[model samples]
Target chain A: MKKSNIKSKHIINHPLFLPLVCLLLVLIVNLIQTPSFFKITIQNGVLYGFIIDIINRSSGLIIMAVGMTLVVASSGGTDISVGAVSALAGAVCVAVLGTGESYRMPYIISLLLPLIAGMVCGAFNGFLVSYMRVQPMVATLILFTAGRGIAQLITGSFILYVKPVQFQYLGSFLPNVPIPTPCFVATFVILITWLTLKYTSLNMFIQSVGINPKASHLVGLNSKMITFFTYVFCSVCAAGAGLISVSRTASIDANNVGLNVELDAILAVAIGGNSLSGGKFSLFGSVIGAITIQALTTTLYAMHVSADQLPLYKAIVVIIIVALQSPEPKRWYYMIKSGISSGRSAREAN
Target chain B: MRIFKKTAAVILAIMMFMSLAGCGNNKAPVSNDSSDTGTDEKSKSIYVGFVQVGAESDWRMANTKSMQETFTEAKGYKFEMVDAQQKTDKQITAIRDFIQKDVDYIVLAPNTEAGWDTVLGEAKAAGIPVIIVDRMIQTNDNSLFTAWVGSNFKQEGYDAVTALENVLKSKGIPDTQEINIVTLQGTMGSSAQIGRTDGFAEKMAAHKNWKMLDKQSGDFTQEKGQEVMESFLKSYPDIDVVISENDNMSFGAVKAIKAAGKTCGPKGDITIVSFDAVHAAFEAMIAGDIDVDVECNPLHGPRVEKLIKALEAGESVDKIAYVDEDVFYAKDAASIIGKRAY
Candidate 1:
């Protein structure tokens, strides 16, 4: 016990400890299920491996999770519209720039425009919920349902194929490396967000407002402004994710772009130990959590579960994870143990 | 000078009144003839009450428009068009209203295959002939509807599988090869999903090696289809084929495959097959992004109009009118690519 406590103290203080532990656990599971899971190889100068693919895919979720964690922590509310917003932003870019030709624009403006679009969507959502006093879930849900439809409508509900060289560069790998630029961008955003929260009063205000919005307002804090700004931040993050997403596909289908991804982000945030009631947030933990989910899915696929049963398996796993991570962990464990012991006793009596 | 002014003013007033009276008479004759000739234009006067499933998709919108246009053009019948908005209760109410209106025939495109026996029984007791259009209603009592005018959904599924198998045969891909098929099913429990899945399974059973790895319902929405396909791709990394019940779902799968840096064809990427040869699907075939597509014709409006006219003429018609459609492979897609509306 003493030795474990000392190890915990050492590990808990380290910023990278949780992520390292998560990676180790995931690797161990993958190794048991598929022996070649850890075997990395260069295929045509691109890194190809189970782990690499998982990481590559988990980047989008991690970015969404970072923003979601902050919004949830700030008590503004959950944004179920990130996925839709991402789709909208991607559709906007493709619908505007896709002519099977190049679009002339300053590089910086091209990068910044999508982020602005996302902010505008977020502000619209914020206005409805904060100013109009609509339910956060209902207000955000309006976009969640209609955003993709509008995006599809704008693109004429068809797939827009663009072979533009500049747009493709966003998804390009680092020079002589297998790491995707989106992965790098996601990492950079995560670090910047974590550092800003760690070093400024913004984090404190978010937490305080989340804990008690009325109290925070009574203390002269601008709750509505904070709520509105947090949503804008969330939307901007989603927009960046969309930009990278389009780059990865090199094409855009508003119907298929960023569907149901908000759930993943929320799940990542929840799994990372953030409170659903809006309090202290965990940026680093959310990234690990997103990676964990991607790894779990990869493991399931490697096991060759049938396609029809995938939904059943997914539901079971999500239920189990949520049950395990329920706030009353002790109660859950006790209930399970009691059920097991009772069943055994009854069988023995029989 | 005063006499000239009076005469000019009287002439102007008479001209204005005559013009107004002529316009009013023109409307009177058109409106009267519209009612009289409207009933006489066909043959026997038959009233039709149509309970629509709502305009949820482009196909549905087209379906509704087709029926409405056809009915409006038909001279002898007064057809009531009801939009159920995909609601069962609304449809039931519509059916009851039709029964109350004592229409000669009732037409319905049921949202689901079940929950219609009671309403249909009432419709039967009322002796109001019912025509099932585009979709099927669930009931063992065939007496509920006078006839059904739609394509065979199960046959459509079978046709899609057949086309896919033909493509595979031409490619010389061995049947024994493990073909991991990810399916984007339509709305659960809907006739389309059941018929498509059953038909596909029946066809694939002959080839023991071809097995479905994963299947999920996208609720007939392109967005849900993509979401399901994204997770399916992540979970089943080695998916070999994708079969969508409809073109929209297949489109979503195509997006996911492309996003993962994979191809979407028998020769290059994920082998794909789908129903509903919407223009998008046809284009995908041309682009070599899709393998096969079976047609589920959305142009049932003209056929419905014909049936309505026949019923109004008091002429006995075939209880079930089957529409024929051709499946398109990439090889033949170029010829018919110009014909798709959706």
Candidate 2:
């Protein structure tokens, strides 16, 4: 019994525990509101249900949050330009595909072209933040404003539409496919990133640089190089997300494709128990965090919440969850618990 | 690193100069040669400066195309076109530029309803006729512009609801039968959202059996529309109709309905009513996925041109000129889908 208690305690104290609890709490609330929340049915050989929809819709944010975790861990600042960069990447890909002229370019070339454009954009941001020594937020703000404009310019200020069957599979389910393609894509990315970090010392180098850049530099770590790579990797992730989004709609709107998604990515990082100041991070935690947000949105919609009041409800719940994870509230809760236990022990002695 | 910095700065400088040169090139033909041409055909050709609100969507693109096609130099009009890129201040600057150029008329499509009073006062003082197109401005002074020409958005909403009612009636749903509806609104607080929501609700109130199951903003995007419709499917399984504020949202709703293993359209379980009779909406209608589409015509070019001619001829124009539009059912959509400009 004692051993079991200790194991349970250890699980509770784990870094991913809070986000899991928050997600569970939301799920339970939803189940209470509608008992069928967890029910999954297969339709036309594909999973058709609310839970599947949440997972599928969250794939873009999950990919974005993975890259964001690395950047936050390395540089101690957030990239506000991920949304715009995603727009630019999608625009580049769609422009090359050339609206109903998809036969002009091979599918692979269309896909690879956007990823390359995203790398260049990421490299520019990395150079500004690493070499020029500019603040990450300010450096990213340049692209945050101009990136969408650049995308508009690429498509000549028109929403580019493509009708490629191969590309549609990225966003939709194929014949007899039981899962959404984006879910598989997101999982593949997460697994690859996890395996790479496990086998290589890149994770250690990033954490050390994030913890103390000057000390890491003195110890022969190329901090600038690490920071630059992280930004580039983050941009690649954003590009992947952009491709999924454009595929979902089969069209690209420069103004609204990845609109305000950076905020959600940052929020996911924070909700995953990672400090905005940078240091130790969790990629899995961020994934769970992204899912939690999508679940919350799904729950709100199921509850028949008005669209205008959604932001207000979201803000209230987010504040409560974040405060529960903060240091001050935890400290207060521990103090109160110890005080009550000590008083009970004294009463027993008397 | 130093060499890289120098090269980057040079590249940026060159880019800046090129953009400035592009802007200068656009302005040169309008101003430098205008005086020469104005002297040659002073009375025959009337110079008109048109300020557009940018091509943000296909509708806006069609609107711009209409203006370009109708107001050409070959048609005896010297047209100076300026795209404001959805910024009110840019539109103001274009108006001021037009005033300085001494153009006979200025056609303004204001991006917002606020902040136009001051610049419009300047246009009025300069004695240049300004015809407001597409959107209205909030000016206490009535004479800030010559006329306002656009669609009555409220009427468009009423037409959409009427079309939906007709579909429901044909499906054997009596007026006394309780009808469940879910509304997918546009961006909240937008003029379209406010007008359409109010108009539909007002008409719906007259039907005692009509009930609004849920109303939420889809932000006029397909992705949001799909997500919202998915949730609505979970919340209200008995939804009889979906009133989408635009065609894009209806497209999304149709996808969601299909994904949920449910049929949509007048012949199906749910009837979808939408605004903005874009080509895609007509295609959906013909496919029997959407039941009704009320036209919110974006092509105001010919109407604005006609008004401009009237003003030049010293004829008085109406205070508010509304363009005529029609409501389309699935049967009628097949006939007109090819001729849709937007």
Q: Which one is best on lDDT?
A: 2
Inter-residue clash pairs, candidate 1: A306-B213, A307-B213, A307-B214, A307-B215, A308-B214, A308-B215, B263-B269, B279-B342
lDDT tens digits, residue span A1-350, model 2: 76996797698779999999988988999888978878788865678778998999999999999999999999999988999989988898888887773556877887899998788778778878887889999988977887887787777777666766566678777656889999999999999999998899998999999999889999999998888889989989999999988887777878888899999999999999899888789898899889989999988887778888998999988998888789897688669877997998899999
Task: Point out where model 2 deviates above 4 Å.
Answer: A1-9, A164-166, B1-40, B72-76, B169-178, B309-316
lDDT tens digits, residue span B1-342, model 2:
577557556645653554455345334222213445444564778788888887677888888888777788788888777877677787888899889878888988889888888898999999998888888989899998889888888988788778877898788988888889999999998888888998999888888888999999899988789889988887777999999999888988987888777899977999999998887788788889999899888778788888888887889989898877889899888888887777
How is the predicted docking of candidate 2 categorized under the CAPRI scheme? acceptable
TM-score for the A chain of candidate 2: 0.96
For all candidates in order, the CA lDDT equals 0.73, 0.85
TM-score of each: 0.75, 0.92
Worst 10 residues of 2 chain A by lDDT: A159-168
lDDT of 1: 0.73
